[model samples]
Target: MDIDRYLGPGHRTAALVTSHGLAVADAAVRLAEAERIHEEKEELAGTLTRRWGTPCHLGLQTVRLRTGTEEIPEPWAGLSLRVGDVYLWQVAEQGRWVALGVADLDPDDEIQLLLVVTDTDPP
Candidate 1:
């Protein structure tokens, strides 16, 4: 899906879940129906782990917790983080932090998206 185009500068987190066994259409249907929430999220992270090697940091927490750091960061600070919505991780390489998670493209889309972030923070 030319996912790379969605990344880089000004990009927030992104989730890219590939159905290793299912066809593209089937995967689309599953995501659209929210059929396997946990599995899809896991696969999204697993795929990234495989592609980028193990992340220097990996965690799971609520959006509130994630945004509650001493100094809230951008995209995040501007986002309307839901109270109970879960945010999966702050995966990073070196000092660059990448917020990765699965979420709906929009409130009405009912489609799960893998959030991808690649922010370079000074060491």
Candidate 2:
């Protein structure tokens, strides 16, 4: 996807719709960028694990999500997240990662998932 054209948001814009609302092409670009960043973080995590050892613990800082909010499992309960959306997570020591979860939030209120990093087998 022409990420630059979509995300930059200028006169040269295209119609793009999402569950959230009617977004310009820039929204798509942002999604793509988030995915790319997630991939990079995963790769970094793998490298770190290989270089170090197993059961390595990483400190999480923040996690950004497009939508949804529900309690995620371990290594993911600390970060805030939105329900029914994709999120980008960044850990202070480990790196970054992407996750999607189903959150149960009360109406008129939003709950975000927590952020944590745990070692997993590389694919």
Q: Of the candidates shown, which would achieve the greatest lDDT relative to the real structure?
A: 1
Query: What would you estimate as the lDDT of candidate 2?
Result: 0.32
Off by over 4 Å in 1: 1-10, 13-35, 56-71, 78-95, 104-111, 120-123
Worst ten-residue run, lDDT, model 2?
A: 9-18
TM-score of each: 0.44, 0.28
Q: Please give, for residues 1-123, the per-residue lDDT of candidate 2 as tens digits.
A: 111222221111111212222133355554564455445545654654565434333222233331134434333432232333323333335543433222223222322222222332111
The TM-score between candidate 2 and the true structure equals 0.28
- Point out where model 2 deviates above 4 Å: 1-25, 54-77, 80-123
lDDT score at residue 119, model 2, on the 0-100 scale: 36
Error of 2 at 56 (Å): 8.7
